[model samples]
Target: MPRKPTNIIYSANEKPPAGTVLILGVQHATLALLFIVYPLVAAAEAGLSFDDTQLFITSCIIFMGIATLLECLPRPGAGMLLVQIPNMAHMPLAVQSLAAGGPALYAGMSLVAAISQLTLSRFMRALRAVFPPEVCGVAVTMLGVALADPALRRVFGISGAITPDLDLRYALVSSVTLVIIVGLAIFSRGMLRLFAVAIGAAIGWILAAYLGVAPEPNASFATLPYIDIPHLGWPGVSFFSWALIPAAIITGVLSAVDMVGTVVSMQRMDDADWRRADLDQAGRAIQANCLGDIGTAITGGFASASSSAAVGVAFATGTTAWRVGAVSGILIILAAFSPRLIGVLTIIPSPVIGAILIYAAAFLTVAGMELILSRRLSDRRIFTVGLAILTGLAVAILPGLVGLTPEWAQPILESPLSISTAVAIVLNLVFRIGIRQEASREVTTADNPFTVATEFLEYQGDLWGARRDVISMAIPVVAEGVEMLLDTGVAPGKLEVRAHFDEENFDVALLYEGEPITIPDHRPSPEDLLGDAHAVARFVGYMLSKRADRLVLGTDGTREKLTLRFEH
Candidate 1:
C-alpha cells in the first residue's frame, strides 16, 4: 500500500526563511557533534597528542562542512538538503588505520576507499538486480546491529572512558537524556520537538557536570585562545597496514549502501511522488560523499559519511532545506578556528553522545526493516534478513568465536556488519532470492514494453490455468495498453506491473506515475490502431475492449494505479 502524502513545511528543493534556515542549521550542527566521538575516541585509543587530536578532528569538521555544502548545492545528480557529518560506520576502520599508521596511514587508505566507492556508485544502476531492496535491507539492518554495542556500552560509560563501570551516576545521566529526547520527539509540538536532541544534550551535560563525570575536558576553557588554527602537514601513506586495497573496496561497498539509504529516506520524506528511487541522484550523492572523504583525508580528518543522525534531524524538523545544511556547514568551518568553542563542544559527556547514538541506531534499524517489509516478506527474505542481523549481533558480542577465519579475511570478518552484508549478498545471489517473494516486477525502459507485458501476463496466466485463448488474448491487450501508455510520453521506467491472485479473482495491476488513464467502455475500431498497417496492433485494439471483466483507474494521491481483473 502507498503511504498517504503529507504536506511538507520545507522540501529539499525549496528554501525556507532565513530564520528557519538558521534554526535548522543550529539543530543540525548539534546533531553533527555526536559524530565527533568518532575521531576523538579513535585518537584517544591511538594515544595521539592533544594537538594531533585537534588537527585530525579539525580536518574532519572542516571537510564535513565542505561535504555538506556540496551535497546541498543544486547539481544535476545531487539532491538538495542533504547533511553530511563524520560517519560512525567507518569509526572502527578509521580507528584501526589511525592507531596502526597514524593520520597519514588513515588518510591515504581513506582516499583509496572513496575512489572505490565512487567507482561503485557509477555502476550502481547495473547492480540493482544483484542487490535489490531485500538484500540492501539486510545489509542496512546488520549495520545498526553491529553499531549498537558500542553505543549501548558508552551509555553506561563502558567505552572510551576512565571509569569503565556501571556507575549509577552515568546511568542516570544517560537514561534521563534518552528520556528527554524521546519525550520531546514523540510528544512535543513544533520547533521544540525538532530541537529535542540539542535540548536533551544540554540537560545531560548539566546533569553530568553536577555529578562530576570522570572524563572532563582538561583544556582550560577560560584561558583558551580566542581563535587558533593548528599547523598541519600533508598526509603520506605508511606501509604499516595490510590488505589496504581490499579493505577499501569492500568497506566502500558498505558505504554505498549507507549512501543509497540516506538518499531514499530523504526522498520519501520530501517528495509526494516518490515511487521509484532516483538512482542517478543517489550515485551523484555518493560522488559528493566520496569527495568529502578524500577532502577529509587530504585536509587531515578521517573519512566522512552521510550520518543517519543528519537524516533523523531532517525528518524530525520537517525542514529539508539545502540552505540549512549549507549554513550549518559554514558554522562548522568557523568553529574549527575557535579554541574556546571547541573546548565547550568537547565537554558534552560521552553518555549524552551515546543516547543520541541509541536514537539514530533505532531509527535506522526500523527504517531498514520497513524498506524490506514495504514490498513483501518472503520466507527467504525472513531467513536472509534474520540470519544477517543475528550473525552481525553474534559477531559483535563474540568476536573471538570468528577467529577461525583466515588472517587475510579478518579485515572483512572482524566486524559483524561486514560479515553479514557479505553473507546476505552471497545468499541472495545463490537463492536468486527475493525468494518466495511477491510477484511484483519493476518496470525498466531497457526492456521492450510489448515483450515485457506479454511475458508478464503469460507467466502468471499459466499458473492460473486460464484458457490458452484467454491467455493469448490478454497478452496483446496488456502489450497494447503498455505501448499506448508509452506513446503518450510516460517514461517506461516509471511504470510497474503487479499481479495478485486469489481463489476467485485474478488481478493484474499497472502502477505508474502519471495522470490517471481512462480505459473507455467503447472498443477501439481496427482502423484506429492499424496505423502503419500493423496487423498485431489492430488486433490488440479490438481485443483490449473485451478481455477484462473490469478496468478501473484510480489515484493513490501520488501515482495512478490501473487494475485489470479477469474472471477465472
Candidate 2:
C-alpha cells in the first residue's frame, strides 16, 4: 500500500469533524457550482425564456448534487471526494439539441450520453494498454493546460484586443488571492492549511466587493424567493430524435475522457504510491456520473461529468474525505431549493475563480510530470508523449485549426484535453507496434554480466513499458545471479537469460549447465562468509533470494534453471 501524503489532514477513508467536513464541503460545493456557467451559457445560446432557463439551471444543480452524493458511496461510486458538475464538453451538443428539438431532445441525448459512459466504464480495464501512464499524464497535464486561457484572461482582465483590457486592480486582487492560498498551504499549519482556498477566495471577494468590481448579491436578492421547490419540467421522452445520436455519442466519449482524467488525478492525490490509473475505481466513478446524467435526462437538464477544478480544490485543501463530499452534496441540493443562496454564490468574483484555477493548474502540471516520469522514457515513449502534447497544444494555440476539420472531427479537436488525449492514446498504440512482451539473450563467458543484464533488461523494460522502479529492482538481482554462476564455475561457455512480462509479473530465467545454486532463506553466517573464498557464492545466492520477490531453482533435463520474479 502507498503511504498517505504528509500534507493530507484527512484521507479519502477517514472522516473529519463535522465542522471541518461542512467547511470543506462548502468549499468544494462553491467550486463545483462555478461550472454552472456552462449550462447557463447553453440556455442563453438556445434562447430559453427566464422561467425555462431557471428550470434548466435548477435541474442541473439537483442532479449535480445527486451525482456527488453517489460518488461518496462505495458501490455506485469511486468512493472518493468527487463532485459532479455540468460538463463544458457537452455544452455545444446540448445547445444544438435544445435549439433543434427543445429540452426534450436535449434530455433524450443526455440519456444517450449516460449510456455511452456506462458502456465505456465496462471496457476501462481492457483499455488499460491504450491509457498507459504517459498517456494519462498527457490528459492530466492538458487538464491544467486547458484551464490556462480562461484563468489568465480573468486574472489580467484581457478581452483579446490590440490594447489588452489589463486592469491592474483586478490583477492585484487575483495576485493577492493566489498569494494567500499558496502562503497558507505552504507556510501555515493545522486548520489554516485546510481552509487555504476558502480563506483566500473569501478575502478576494471582499476586496473585489470593496473595489466595486464584484456584483453584490443584494441586487438580485429581491428577485428570488428564499426557498422554493423547483419544478421538474420533464420534457417527456416522446420528443426523441434519431438524427442526434452521433452528437450524443460524441458528447459521451469526450465526457468520459474528461472524467477519466479527473479520476486519474484524484487517484494520484489520494495515494502516494500511485503507479497507473486505477481503472476499477475510475469505472465506478463513470458509472456514478452516468447515473447522475440519467437523472438529469429525466429532469430535462444537461449532461454532467466529474469536476477537475473541484478535485483541485480538494487537493489544495489537503482533505479528500468522502464525508466532505456528502456534506457538499447536501448543501448543493439545498442551494438548488434556495434561489437566493444560488444568487449569492453565482456572484463570486471572476478574479477569485481565476486565482484558484492558477493554483490548480500549477499542481496538476507538476503531478502530470510525476506520472510521466514514473516509467523509464525510451525514445519511442519520449516521442509518443512529446508529439501528443504538441498536437493537443496545436488546437489550443490555433483555435481556428478546428474549423478546418470536418464537422464530425471538430468535436474531438474542440479542446486541448480531448484532442491531446485522443492523440496520446493513438500514439501510444502506434509506438507499441514491434515491441514484444517476452525476449531473451545469450550471455557469454567473456561478457560483463552486469553490463549485459542492465542493457538487455533496460531495453525490454522500455519495450514492455514496465515501471522503472520494478525493473531497477530486478536488474541487480539478475546480474547477481549471472555473476554467481560465473564465479562459482557452475556454468561454462554460454548461459541464457530469458525475460517475460505480462503487465503483471516480470520474470527472469537464467538457464545454465550445472547444478542449481544454493539459495538460503536466511543470511549466511560470518563463518561461511569468511571461511573460504567460494563460500562467498552462497552469500551472493542468499542476497539474490532476498532481493527477488520469489526465487525458484530447478533442472530441465541437461540444464539447470534459476528464475527471479518481481511482482509488478
Candidate 3:
C-alpha cells in the first residue's frame, strides 16, 4: 500500500503555473552548474591545457541543454522533467583515456559509451524486470558512497596547484552554508525553501569572498568574447591505447543506474498512479539522454547523465515543471553565448559546490536505501544489497584492492558503480530462487495493505492455476487482519507479508520483528479502540479465527510470525 502523496505542488510531467516557471528555471540553471565540476576536475588531473578545458566545458554545457530539451519534450522522451549532464561514473575512464591518448581518445570512448547506452533503450523494457528497485537501489547507493570522498575534497578546496591547501575557512563556509540550506528546507513553509541551495550558496560566497577564498564581484566577465567558437582537434586513437574500448563498454552499461534512479526519484515526487518503474517511459528518457551526447565525439565534449543537482533543486523548489527543463535548456544555451557566465560558473566557490554535491550525494544514497528497504528485507535481498554495497565501497576506497587487479582491468574495476551494479544484478538472479519461493513483500500504507496482499496472492495463484474466485473470497477476511496490523504503527521496513502455495491451498504470513502478542476472541472494549494497541491485535486475532482455515502464532528468534492459511 502506498501512502497518498502530500504537499505535491507540481509533478514531474506537469507544468507549474506560468508565474513560477522562470524562477524555477533559474534555480534549475544554477543547479546545472554542479555538473561541470566533475569534468573540470578531471581535466585538471589530466593536465589539460586551459584551451582544451574550456572546449570541454563548453561542449558539455551545450550538450546538457540539448539532452534536457529532448527529455522534456514528449515526442521521443519519457517527457519527464530531467536535467542531463556528463556522468561521473565515466570520470575515471575519461581521465585515463585523456592521459593515454588525448581529447580524441576521450571523445571517441565517450561517443561509443553514449551510443551503447542509447541502444539499451530498446531492451530497457525487458531489462527493467531484471533490474528492479532493489538492485537499482543497491547500485545507486554504492555509487554515491564512492563519491563521498570527492565531495569532501571539494569542501576542502584542494584540487591542484590552483588551490592546493585545505582551507579551514572553506570548512566554515561550507558548514554554515549546509546549515542554512537544511535549516531553511526544514523550517520554512514558503517558496524560500525551494531556493535554499541558491540562497545558501550566495550567502556562503559572500562569506568566502571576505575570507579570500572566493572572487569578489567584478566586471572581468565583460572581457569575455560574445561569440567565441570552440574547435579543439579531437585526438587520434592508437593501438597503444586500446584500453579505452573496455572502459567505454563498462561505463556505458553501469551509467544507466544514474538515469533510471533519477527517473524513479521523479516518479516518487510525482506520486503518480503507478509509481513502479514504467520501463517504456524510462527507455525513452534514456534514449533522449544519450542523443544529447553524440555531439561529444565531434566536439570533444563529455557524455551526459541525469543531473542530481537539478533534481535536488526540484525537491527544494517543490516544482518539477517540464517548463523548468525547457527554460533551463534555453538558459544553458543562452549562457554559452556569454563567456562571462561560463567564467562565473568556472569560478564559483569550490566549497559551496562541494556542499551542494555532498547534499546531493547524501540524498541519492538515502533514496537508494529507502527504495531497497521499502520491500521485505528477506535474506536474499539482504545479501544482494549488503554484499554489493560493501564490496563496491571497498573497491572504490581501498587502494590496495584495486592495485591487485590486472593493469588493463584496473580502469573498470576502479569504478565501484560498474562493479556494484554488476554484482547486484548477478546476485539478484542468483537469489531469485529463494526470493520467488518465499514470495514475501512489504507495503507502506495501512489504507490498502490488504489490496496489495490480495494482488500478490492472485499473481502467486497463477503459478499453480489457483482459481481467481477462491482468491477473491480470501480478500475480505485477509483485509481485516492487515488493517489491524497496519494500525499498530509498525516501523517502516519492519512489516513483511509472505504469500505462497502448497498442494491445493494458498498460504500467507505476516511477519515482523517483535514479541508475539495475544489475540483475544471477544470484541475489544472502547478503551482498546482508543489507545490500547494490544486490544486491536486481539480483536484482529478473533476475526482471523472465524475467517481463516487456521491461524497459527509462532516465533523464530526475534521475529513474531502470523500465518494465515486459505484452503480452497
Best by lDDT: 2
- Candidates by lDDT, descending order: 2, 3, 1
Q: Per-residue CA lDDT of candidate 3, range 1-568, in tens?
A: 2332554566665666665777777767766865677788789989999888888887888878888888887778777778776677778877888887888788778777877787887897668557766776776576467667767877887665445455789888889888888877667866777678779889988988888988554776667776666444455433345667777876777666667767777766666333246677778888888787776656787777887666666666666767778887787767767676777776788788778777767767886786675444556667888888887888866857888887667766777766777788888777766335447777555447667867776666543334455577667766666666666754234477777764346677887765576767666676776656666677668778778887888875677878888774
Error of 2 at 195 (Å): 0.4
Best by TM-score: 2
> In candidate 2, which residue pairs clash?
none
Per-structure clash totals for the candidates: 0, 0, 4
Per-candidate RMSD, Å: 10.2, 2.2, 10.9
Reference-based TM-score, model 3: 0.73
CA lDDT of each candidate?
Answer: 0.69, 0.85, 0.72
Better of 2 and 3 by TM-score: 2
**Residue 70 lDDT in model 1?**
81
Off by over 4 Å in 3: 1-4, 44-51, 158-166, 215-222, 226-242, 272-275, 434-568
| Cα displacement (Å) at residue 184, model 1 | 2.5
Better candidate by lDDT, 1 or 3: 3
TM-score preference between candidates 1 and 2, better one? 2
